[model samples]
Target: MSGRRSPGDGGLYWDEKRGRWIASLTVGYTAGGRRIVKKASGKSKTEAKNKLKEIIRDYEDGLALTSSNETVAEAVRYWLEHGLKGRGDSTVILYTGFANNHVIPAIGARKLKDLSVEDIDRWLAGKARQLSTRSLKIIYSILNRSMRNAIVRDKVKRNIVALCEIPDGCEGRVSKALNLNQAETVLSSAEQADARIGGYIILSLMTGARTEELRKLSWSHVVAFDAEREVWLPVTETGWNHTDYAVYVWRSVRQGGDTKTAKSRRTLKLPQHAVEALRRLWEHEGLDKTDDCAGLGERLVFTTKNGTALSAGNVRRDFRKVIAKAGLTAAEWTPKELRTASCPCCRTPVSPSSRSHAWSATAIRRSPRPSTASRSTP
Candidate 1:
């Protein structure tokens, strides 16, 4: 019986002692022994043959006998908590929000092995229905990153979400800025006011500086340049609000901090009008008696009555008030809109040069026969 090979049964035979047709396979060495494995049930011969064939094929393919069986939610959590542990706090918040609000609810229970490209597309479409395309894109990026981590661990074979596209209507909607007349009216209204809010409004409109950059402007980065000399800082140590005029470098806010992009970091010369507004703000704050006047290099350009940093929310609220007080429509006015919409003759975006009131140069140069320098707005 031991020497005889069974016909058409592969390695399967009837074990008389066990009273069953035992489907035996020769597995590789285990503990210095050639382990022969057998599986049997009181089933038909065909069923036995099929089951044995599957097990043998799987073994030959170098597949594990058991799976990690990591669920999507569980795997994503592990990936986030361990793999992305070193990411910034803001990034972590964004990823966590996307997972909690979008990914987990859709297909979180499925094992990582079971995720498919179709599953990702369906999930992305459903997310697009709820969130803006930009928000949906963020969620997709996080989930895709998580799945890629799973691939690295051999938990999944591919990243399905990478094949998906951001759905329609999920794009960045560009809000138009105010025209030149409206910008003039808004700036004029802010100028007549007795508070730093007016100056903040003017700065935003003139330089296209983001709200926080203006509010958090310090004296250290204030470069004083005249047409006579290239840019340089004055020796006098005065608070930014007290300085007559100064150049604002977008980078001076915080090196390697949150900003839109590298191109967003700009240097714009503040006009005399804006400089006067800053001086008045300085006198109003009574900084003459404070250490900040000596150019301590740390004072909020726009602050509350008590000299605390001005919140963007509060600035927007006050900006609307100033607009209304000036008999302007709040609907048509936003600080960002005011900055970018002022110059159509040049047909260029709001730039540091445009902010410096160099409209004529920018306008005349755009005669269709462009200079190489004219094409580069940076």
Candidate 2:
């Protein structure tokens, strides 16, 4: 019965088809100049008007309305394309694989605004049954990051993934160490291999250096310390001579050539066997005379015959061949296990607290083969 309300006051009308009141308002215009209208329906005029007022208040409060048709897959794709700047290539590849293989195929079709905590929970639980715990964490991180990016872009109001808990997933691979006999066999087999493989195996097994660190080792980082001692000479009273060799584990193949951790950047004294193997490798490669090995000691210690860095796949394939020659199952071994094997080669018993320091000292003292007992004089 009231006079027609002004345009700014909004419009309320009866919908006889559905037997409810409808309220409508134009909040703004789209990029193409199309009117963007907001609508609300209720059983009574007051109820519909209240709903419209709530929407208007939200808009005035800076809440951008998202399209109901925008989907999780679109959000994820947008983040993958725009949000991954400065990330490493391997990391981007891994994230893309998880999204395409696991996330996108599952709940990616769900509307971004309509996605619920229950939906995320169910998806994670299903993934827990098949993927490892580490893998589950990676996928969850991807979803959480994507949703955050969507929120910043006004694609969604909130990130529902923040409310979901990550569940425990399938077990990951277990690492094992070689025993004394196995270590001896591996060393012996490595000694018979090509100079590069033999030197890499000995250095890795004896020094507990990571494969990644070894891959980035440069000749400049190799140092020889000279020891001074007093000698009974007619004219000279002292003599200085080289007593020890050490290698600086200061770089890795990771981005920016940074080690995995600050603690990983250390100087390790080379054991006798390791020094011998390195010497053989240097002579075999003719590094002493090659112009490539001139003033710049930055040349990599381990590489192909053509002086190029070896790929991970190439190293793994060559390592498996060495393992097979040692009479061990190649399927059960990896280059990383050599670090674990170094722990047991220590001659002295190591306390759990001082394992790191004691293990290196032990490796220096003990040889690959068992020592023979000395016979007492009669």
Candidate 3:
């Protein structure tokens, strides 16, 4: 027999500087007659040879063995840079924050190709001790998606993350839904507060509108039925004198001013309290004084005195004040919880199953407001 075992069989040798066994082979020759060599290294000949077999097997199965020696950090950065190309700025910011603060610090130094299911499992398990399950899932997705895209560009052979399951993490903050009594108190307190916040709270708690949706409300969307004209006109056209009123829940503070979903686009009839609150806001705004009621159509319904859109921080701060005034722990509540309690408190006017005052029998009246700014309605 010849010294070489076979033409297609691989060769094994020891690397002097590396002090490891190398399994090397020629898979093909380029058009220029240059030999294309592939390699896999290990501390022992048996380990190197077994890895070489896998590489050869994969190559024969039509997978290219051109993986780079990239680190987890590089892979993650690549995904963060390119993977989220069309995502919203807020979404990108959220993922970037999680990746920097959690994912990279944990396993950024590890080799992408060498990452294993055990590695991912262990990493997620460690994170579970410190993060909430939602946080853990987010970080896991960052790694998992990074490795998956890496495979598309031949950076790695497989994604071990897909094989690993996310472990349960610490408990996250849960939304606290108010019972009937609590809901009543919050509504009453809100009405007694500033008219702007009163309208905000009344609309939020009574209509079950999301905070984003409410913040994006415009005067044009606040429509009132014109009994004579038999058409819905903007609040600016009809003012608050009309009895039948509704709000077009067609916009939100999302990136493009879109509702959360197609189904989220809706029309909500104003409850008695919500109408009172908005009527108070209209008078408090004094657009009629400016004789610019026509121009108020495009103006946002809820905004700061400076006419800027209400931010999440702004809503939270004002909401806490109302909660505190209602004799509840301000720090423990958020604006979203009102949505949960609003479901039954508000019913569609036309729905046969509608029940009146399901949450509070106490009607919401226009609480007296004290503004330094002169009010024309005063």
Candidate 4:
């Protein structure tokens, strides 16, 4: 009597008042124990069934009609609160800042289901004025990943953000390094005044060690060669000057105090200039030799006069002074750039004992490609 139809086939019947065929399906039940029904209307019964099929396709693709009221801000907030499980605190702070400052403020009012390619495009275009291209890309990644998380949880049917292309953003600061001539001036200038910074520049330029790696160097890692025994002994054991020397580069100031990469941990034979500079520092500090390595090795090779660890600010301020002393523009250069300086095989060549380490074996001969690539801008 009633137009109930088969269970999956959906009910089709003529609506006399509207003069149209109406199709309705009792697909399932809602979480609150209410029936979930879908309905469509068309002039013909066939058209009504086809319209019903379209709704089924959308449901199959994970699109939920009830989620239409969920806003983009809600989705972004959900991700910020509960999504980042293993991510670092700094990452959480950074992503939260980006979302709140840049992303959410612009498009957060829109419904998640209604977000479109044009919305994202216009948002990214506006950001181009304020952020660098790299920063824009990062925010774009954050948005795209958030949308992907929403899709997996059935908050949305698909990630339209994935379809959006990143637009070019504002320019960024340029990175550069000293050339060979400038390297000579900095070396000569530092050696005349401060052994700490002198050894820093020589070792950084000669070995290409990162600034963080150098700062974390301890006395125990510095080893002096034993001519008779043919071995490398800690500066803690043998004191500062032996014929040849090397440093065990196993430490850094990275998260958990590990090197940036597995291969970054290495042994580097000191260049003659670096050795002399470190020797001067050892004597200047008047550090005493000790038989117990546990105590002696823990002593940092470089630190503030207060014996605390050096901060980036401390290094940068001192390094700029060194730059000014070298007759170079202090405002234009940085300590990290020393590693990227061209022709590392400056006048104070690596000691003939370079063969002791694998990287140092060819270190004296193979200079990294000219560092002029980054300076192409300014």
Candidate 5:
């Protein structure tokens, strides 16, 4: 026989061995005979009874458990593989990165039913102690969403992870950006390292172009009006530029997205120093490719020694070493930090213009705003 039914929800079941009341919600009408059962963890019957009531109410109202059969690991894989479809490539990559790096290692094997709110809270706390709060927040969100999917499908009684609190005061304040002296050191360092990297770094700092934008930059994107060049005057053309030569931000390559905002896609002008560096790079890489210029017009400015588009991972590793050798605190200074530290507003500004038909309209900005008060970690 069933225990008592509270108000509008399904009846409860009393487990003889466990000596507790479990929430049993059966849905699918008539001959279907499908049973959806949820349990509340408490020693006393009354305590479990009340919690069980809530689960039945939610279930009856159509919040059934969907992700019950799979382990947390299986659910996460499905979530990334299918749930995140139609999202940007970068989004998929980031989710995959976090699941593999943090979630799978910590709680992947645990059954969804075995995971408790307290267990999740403890995991998040540990992550907070080690990683940036931003990362933890992302993890929290992924778990919350993944479990929420389970709930709607009648797998779990509720999204237990939604109850977990995000760590407070864990994010470091924004402290990136280089002053003039530091900018010169970095630029000179890049110059001494390799003319190619030197020009790329200087252009990045000056134009505020994204690393990938520079990576995918082709000679076609840069239009020096022959008339303007002959006159030694600022060409009224714009591709992309920044107010700070040290801090450049353009588009995200991983996602193939444009600037994060309409304001971000505006054109920028380089300082005299940055232009000079670019001129040298153009002559070297440009000329080298011209003779064998098999793909001279492939449309990327920064390339590998073999003239293919640059990779972000390779650039970070190689550039960090170069920056360190150049006398910058390589550990604290990153390519991104260079852009943030330098004030591009100090450079010659460029005006924004629409790309012609020859240029593919692939410009779309990624969101610059980080997830601030989310329930998950990344």
Candidate 6:
């Protein structure tokens, strides 16, 4: 009797160079009439044949096996190059930095198709010992997003990262608000600063506006009169004449130029300090030299000497200078922390009632001050 033959069984042979059993099969043919072969190798004939059977089953299920050799690093680079179109420059820089500094250096040489859940779990576990929870989350997101993109492009069949749990990492930095004394020192230092940065610091601290929003503030948004009431005011009015001065926080530096949230897009009544700072800025920059007080040319409030928008790095460097002059360690301060410092100066805590009429308090409190124990003389 002839030996029994199973349907779709491939030929098995010994591979002398690899010293292993090899199973080879003709799964299909290319459009050009070329044979498409699939092979599996193992220590024994039974192992090789079993792997071949699994590969044949996958082939019959209509899954493509073309990206078996793609590496994790290549996949990440592809995603970073193609997936982040139209993202803000800062965002792209940040994402790319994380991918190169963390993800690519760790397991980027692994084959994308061969990546396993255990491999991901072990990699994350190792990272947890050195990275912060926030950083780990970011890297995990990068890998997850890259793998998903690869799957869409048929570079890989599955995202092994999705099957792995993120291990707990180290604690991130804690954010703190400046006490009253610190706020006073910063404001005082700003008073003696250049008009551009001084105005930015005053407006940010007094109005509690975000640094991003301040970066996008335009000269047109600053109001100084009430057209309806036909009255000349020291500050700009928004919608009505309830306040002498105000600013429209309708935009930010984010992609699409929208505020961080709908609640962040309200009108802010300028405090006396902010109004004086803006007046000094206008005179110092000769902004009133133009006839269009409404700033029809779309002039940015804060910019470099060459009229270009200031980068975040430029603003941070300038802010650090001011902080250092204020007798504070520049390393511990950031431009965004000004908003936190302004919270205590609010007449009322941020609430729904305060948000509807004005986004922040009209006046900053100057009493109940704390001693300047931590302040240093510059």
For each candidate, the alpha-carbon lDDT, in order, equals 0.61, 0.75, 0.79, 0.75, 0.60, 0.75
lDDT of 6 by residue, 58-100 (tens): 7787766552688999999999999999888888999999999
| 1-378: candidate 3 lDDT, tens digit per residue | 338647677777889999999988788899999998988899987899898888779878877686588999999999999999878888899999999998899899999878888888888999999999889889999999999989888889888888988889998887668887888789889989988887898788877778998898888778777778667777787677777666777788898778877867766666666777888988898875667686887789999878899988898999899999999999999998887784455423423222332223132232112122211110
> Which is the better candidate, 1 or 5, if ranked by TM-score?
5
Which candidate would rank higher by lDDT, 5 or 6?
6
Per-residue lDDT of 120-232 in model 1, one digit per residue for the tens? 88877777767886787777777888888877776765677778787854555568766677667777788787568887776666555666566657654444433243224
lDDT of 5: 0.60
Ordering by TM-score: 6, 3, 2, 4, 5, 1
Task: List pairs with backbone clashes in candidate 1.
Answer: 133-170, 177-337, 178-337
- Indicate the residue-level lDDT of 290 in model 6: 51
TM-score of each: 0.65, 0.75, 0.77, 0.69, 0.67, 0.80
Candidate 2 residue pairs that clash: none
Against the true structure, whose TM-score is highest? 6
Give the clashing pairs for model 4: none
- Better TM-score candidate (1, 3): 3
Q: What is the lDDT of residue 190 in candidate 1?
A: 83
Q: Which stretches of candidate 2 lie over 4 Å from their true place?
A: 1-54, 60-62, 226-243, 304-306, 343-378
Per-residue lDDT for 88-137 in model 2, tens only?
87678889999999999998999888899999999999999999999999
Tens-digit lDDT track of model 5 for 1-378: 656555556555668888766655554445566544455645676877687666666666766544355678876776777788678766788888998999988999988878898889888888887778788878888888888776665567667887879885266646777787777677667777677777777777655566656775555334332332231111112212322221123344645456555555533434556656765776775454354433343446677788766777767876787788767777776676555544433333332221110012223242122122211111
> What is the per-residue lDDT of model 4 for residues 249-270, given as tens digits with 9 covering 90 to 100?
7788765677777777766776
In terms of lDDT, the best-performing candidate is 3
